[model samples]
Target: MSVSSHLLFFFSSLGAFNGLLLALFLLLKKDKQYTDNWLAILLILLSVRIGKSVAFYFTPTLDKSILQLGLTACLLIGPCILAYVAQSTLNNLTMKRLTITLSCFTIATVITGILFPYQDYLALWQYWIYRGSSYLWLISLVVASVMYARKNTYKLALSKQLLTQQPVVVLAGSWLIWTAYFTASYTSYIMGALSFSLVLYLTLLLALKSKWQEKASTTQSKYQNNKLSTEQTTRFSNLLNNLIETEQVYLDPQLTLPRLAKRMSATHTQLSQLLNDHYQMNFKQFINTQRITKAKESLKTYPEMPVEEVAERCGFSASSTFYSTFKQQTGMTPNQYRTTEI
Candidate 1:
């Protein structure tokens, strides 16, 4: 092997190793919800895919077998990411059907690959179909994530749940790493896999730090009040009510969980727990409900008010966003709701 190939093998191996570690950590992590499991599986599959790159550059003997394995890994990447995003944002039971459908697609593709396991076919399949699908699925998920974030009253809430960076930001970073890897690997550029490894390592570090922060926050909360007393809970609830009903704080377009918590004189965790335990909604959902209620009144009271202006008055960031959110919440557009109700 040349110097460049040696470098590729070493760095790509490093990335695969880091990814494996991250996957194990996430898999064994207790108390994880749906997104965590999906992310772990994504990491594992990605690790194997990178491992195939290492083999291609370094191990000419085991080329065909590992190529097939890598392509199989590639097949799962899209479906797994789509499932992860759906669970993370929508959190709906219907996503189970989506998962099943994706699984069927992956199985069918794998069966086809097995049936046509020749170098010519495999090369075409991997280069044209699977590689493109991997990037395309990730892009779709990224766009969905961006839309999900923008549609919410608090742009960062969903991101906080998924990644340390905003979902788009993280996905953007992932895309850059992927783009570099794709261009470099296809051309046999020595440094192509290097960027992917380093980015994966950085992501692992960020995820770990985020996890630690969560743990520390939970511990501190447990130590501080050791669970809210009945009186304290009532007081906090009342404060939240005053903030929402009296102050109408949800009218702010930039309303966020941390900001609202500050206004309530409560910790972010405490406020989050309050909503989760009591209202059974996250901050965005709770805030949107309030906004939708107020929007309905405006639409009814002033039928002449433009739908765009109504959305702005209701704290939506964009007119399009407002329409979508309003429709989502009430099952009717603002115009329809106005006509029907008035």
Candidate 2:
């Protein structure tokens, strides 16, 4: 192989290898969540499919069964993407429903592979299964995008929303872009592998940058002798209370310090200072306090409601966080607090 071809092979194959390794790590992770498992499955499927593309682009005589496996991986990718989106955003997909849906698709793929056997049915596999799987990927991406927008209240313009640095949004957008590349006839077959490489590296860079910023923010003094005046402090205090109590912005699990500061027509630094000096807490603590208070009320008023539902209603994001925070604040578990009364 020429140096250029070797470079292309290296560039594309590196991502697939790294993706498989990452997927294995996620699978073996002790503290992984449902969404994490789905994400791991997604990485595995994408890596397999992309690896097939890289191999087939260089070697025309690749095994038929390998081709079939790659396409079957494509068939499974859509469902995995959809499941990840649903579990991450809505958190309402029951394990039973997920199992049934994936099982049906897996069974169908296995049966079709057995009967058609791409070695003999190359035309059918290339024309029908390939196109069908690509379209399924596209449709899944569109549906997942709609679901995310609806559930997450993504109201920004298309350009702005796509430009947002949120991980889930970025993942969906990257998949959509990859699907477009593969579905278009003009694009090279190897472009999908290249695209995955680019996406993976970009995601890693963004993640590292985010962590660095978080560490920098923590190490540096946020306010650094910044203090609000008495009158300014009083006015801001009332506004903050109204925003939390009357508007109940704390009910949004996606609410962040910067978002709340924007709602208050203040800068995050100013808001942070006020929260620290006046409330004796930081943004997360203050928000969790409000959420815990709301949870306490719900637990008392609705004894029959499931703890998970209560956690969701109270903006806890995850039941584990809710349980921990409830215990920390009230010196008891939510159930104990509920049953013990005042």
Candidate 3:
């Protein structure tokens, strides 16, 4: 085979291999909804490109027909796929609307293409118009994906302090791929098509690598946080247990933190520090969680009791305070919660 033929096969094999790898990854990790959808869409694109490459190798004369078909697919389904991937990744309502819009445009383009098969000058004009629309859609898809990736990175960064740089690197790499492929001067169909395929493959590989690294880092951070959180929880649980079981401090309607601290034989400052630093809760929330927990039990078992009586039994000083705390925590007042019981 000639060098050109050899190069075609090489790109085709590489594209198909990448598609199969992505498909396998998706199948293996079917539980992750976002990654699975992305891999699935990517596999579709790769498969199509591979077929195009193979067709190009076997029949050089049908190159224009093949190019037209490939570009048409790219124009029609490319945006939809990108939009779907963006929506899945970000789970954003805005992206959903964008996906819907792209789907509608794809439908319209298909209808137009079918009505006017490109044989004459007018049909050719119509074809180019639709093709331009597809390019515009592709541009939109690229922009949306970049925006979603940036937003996802920002959210991840805000949630964890250690995850500062991974998102930025992924975003930068993606932008670079887009820039290199789109800004090149070689307007030949083969070069353009190959460049698009190369950029997409590289983008997927980098994205998956960045995502895996981010998840690993996130998992580690979560494990550490959970460990620390559990320790705080245990300490608080012990404190509450002592308050309810041994000292019986909940029986005091006016059980302030200072008084409870005195009864627990710890300084008020030390108790306050425990609530704030370890539990990351203020004294009011700590006391109210205990009160509301007790109130829930009372409401469940003592259905005949008045709401006010339940409030008083839970060591709440007033009915209003009990109602407010209950609503704040459960999104409903005590009476409403009781009414919906079971």
Candidate 4:
């Protein structure tokens, strides 16, 4: 009932609402689904956790139910982070067993929390132990994501564009900010305010950026507007298409926009505009399309070639990515598609 308590609740509610909207965007937005569904799940979990904090502070009776619900959501954070980062880096293992195990653990945890009082096993020491482990696990995922980005530099499309570190850093920063509230009790409300502010700012910023970047990128180049006339643009497009389709530039498996632009004697932005305007896709999507097209041809032309080889020859860094891209593009796995073709 204190003024400070009410303020923290209000701000936390704001953060929660922002997070919910973002999760909805990920679920239903028209961006054509570049991000994995796991990211949306992660955001939902996070929104619940943030909202739970507000409930915890507002409820004078200190409801164990609200606290336990947040704990349950928190438990899955590590696994989801690992799964998302792994998939983002082109290491898209289904990890079904791991998911099942985590699910069971979450269920068991919820049951235990309900059966026992929060004061019993969920003491200060126990809470810190779990929180510490969760932080470590998250840090490990961030490090692993960065390491994979480095090691698989050639795996540009999936490895680099899968997940950016901005969200991860924001996640870590929010954790530390919220954690500081407990350590520095005198500044609890202040830290809570700061945490909620960061969440709202970053969440809205991301949504706006996502919604507007296509438009922004469209006008980003003067060359795209009028530097090249229609005929010139057509010629460049033809040349670029010929270069990739006939010369097989995509076979390198690391054919980024910059590399393609260099080969075409055009700037990166120009190439981006060319693809965006001509193909209605970003550079990565365009490249992946070419790869998938090549994969389809290979499947029928060289029926004896292993699917793995076909994946590599088609410029996919991993067979998993190949199958996923192929399935996503054609609605069938490579083997299934091959069967239908032959």
Candidate 5:
């Protein structure tokens, strides 16, 4: 390759390499949430797919199996991105539903690959599989966009807050841009990879910015070094318990730490210290625990009640959140749990 060609190769391939590294970091990170796992999977699949494209664009004679592998990764990217965004927004269908959908897609892809290997059916692979995968990816993006819009319709006015609060929107928009470039005949094949590289660096910058803000907030907060004494801890715990059990304050979907603290006649620092020190949970975690507990009881008692209604009654702002949280806590989706109870 010439000097310019070599530089292009390096630039195009850099993103895939960094993406794989980022995915590995996410996988190895401790105390990962479901959203983290989905994001990791999305990154890994995207890296594989992009890597395949860069290789094929440079070396058209790449092995057929390698081509097949890349296309399969491409096919999976649609579902992976959908799941990642959905999980991030807490607006996903049940995990079981997602699993079944993915399994069906995998089975179909495998069967087709076996029946007509890419080497034997190059045209078929080039046309049908390529188009199908691209369409699926577009469909996933459309669906995810609609879901996010519905979830954050009210927050759209505050662009800064939207970027910080829904980083997934920025990521999804980046993915959309890459997809458009990849599918457009006017754009060079390497342009897609370059777009991905740009987005990956943007993601890194956003992540670092968030971390810095968090560190700055902690440094500024008076409660950073605040701790409850044993007696104060006991007293605060009793107050929290009474607020939750007696008042059932967790039923309010709009509840916040400050609001709850005010209600409990305690300062935010005291309430935060109580939850963190005594329960080993943050404010949101503690509140979600109470809500999940209530959901479990409601699920068992009123098996006839719709799961959505149960979720609302138990204080979840969205049924998707309820489904994900209940499964996380109870090892079953609401419907699955209901079936077992029956």
Candidate 6:
């Protein structure tokens, strides 16, 4: 075999091998949603690359038969992998609709290609349409993946970054390979380079997975540091409820940590520590939450009371603090909430 052919064989095999490993890892460790979906996508793309390599080896020329078959597979594989990734990452129905649309498009492309094989001009036109449509769909998938990653509630900061970055990298790499293959002459050198790049890309995905695991570990540690033991949490909750029920703490205009701690029969240091360590919030936020709860009740039951009256009745020192705290907790200002009720 020539040098280029040998390189193609090696890279093609490497791509296939890495893809198989990714697929197996995902299948075995299906507990992680992000890793599983990403691995599945890698597998699909690698499979398509493998098919393309084999097709090129068999067909010496890029004619109607080769173009038809290769383009059809490309169209099918790109969208299928994207849809699966989106579904797995977002866990939503949008992925399902995208998958269904891609599937229908793939079927139509295949039917048209098969039916018009002898009509070379028509076949080429159908091929370009399918390719253009698939490219647009791929771009949409990239955008959706980005939006999902940005808005996802995944607690690990690094995991979110990795999720956001990896998809764009993959899309860029795929575009480069597709552009090189279609715009330039078909050579084993170009094909091999693409295959090798894909292999490297897949290896980077493994790094991403490792980063995700590390982020998960950090998140668990943070959770442990912030969380209170069940017994302590329950005791704190009971004490908080009792303080609010008595209305003594609420009536104190200068309600401070030392005063509240004394009323609860706890030292200032102990109460401050409990509020900070257990609730992951400062004493002010904890107190504001209670005040907001009371204000909400007053708003519903006594609509005739002015907002300022409600704030003062709820133990808030100022209307500005009351409005800010209420909005932060309920995602609406006092006036907006009252309007909603009516």
Question: By TM-score, who's the top model here?
Answer: 2
Error of 5 at 228 (Å): 15
The alpha-carbon root-mean-square deviation between model 5 and the true structure, to one decimal in Å, is: 7.1
Query: Per lDDT, what order, best first?
Result: 2, 5, 1, 4, 6, 3
Clashes (backbone N, CA, C under 3 Å), per candidate, total: 0, 0, 0, 0, 0, 0
Cα lDDT tens digits, model 1, 1-38, are 78976665777789878888878987898886546777
Error of 5 at 239 (Å): 21
Model 6 vs. true fold: TM: 0.48
lDDT to native, each model: 0.71, 0.80, 0.58, 0.66, 0.77, 0.61
lDDT tens per residue, model 6, 273-312: 6888777778888888777877888888888888877876
lDDT for each residue of candidate 5 in 1-342, tens digit (9 for 90 to 100): 999999989988998999999889989999876677877887888788889978988999899999998888888877877776666454234645776777798798889889999999989888988888888888887777786676555445646545654345445654654565566688677787777787888767877897796566556556455876888888878888888888787876656786677666667777888888789999988999999889888888998888877887787867778888899888999889888987
Off by over 4 Å in 2: 28-34, 92-96, 154-169, 222-239, 242-247, 254-285, 292-314, 319-342
TM-score of each: 0.61, 0.76, 0.47, 0.60, 0.70, 0.48
Top candidate (lDDT): 2
Better of 1 and 6 by TM-score: 1
Which residue runs of candidate 5 sit more than 4 Å off their true CA positions?
88-93, 165-174, 180-183, 222-282, 285-304, 307-309, 312-342
Candidate 5 — what's its lDDT? Answer: 0.77
What TM-score does model 4 achieve against the real structure?
A: 0.60
State how far residue 38 of model 6 sits from its true place (Å).
Answer: 7.6
Residue 205 error for model 3, in Å?
Answer: 5.8
For model 3, how does the per-residue alpha-carbon lDDT over 125-223 read when each residue is reduced to its tens digit?
346654574565457557756665553443344343222333343333334433433454454324434544575566666667757965674465444
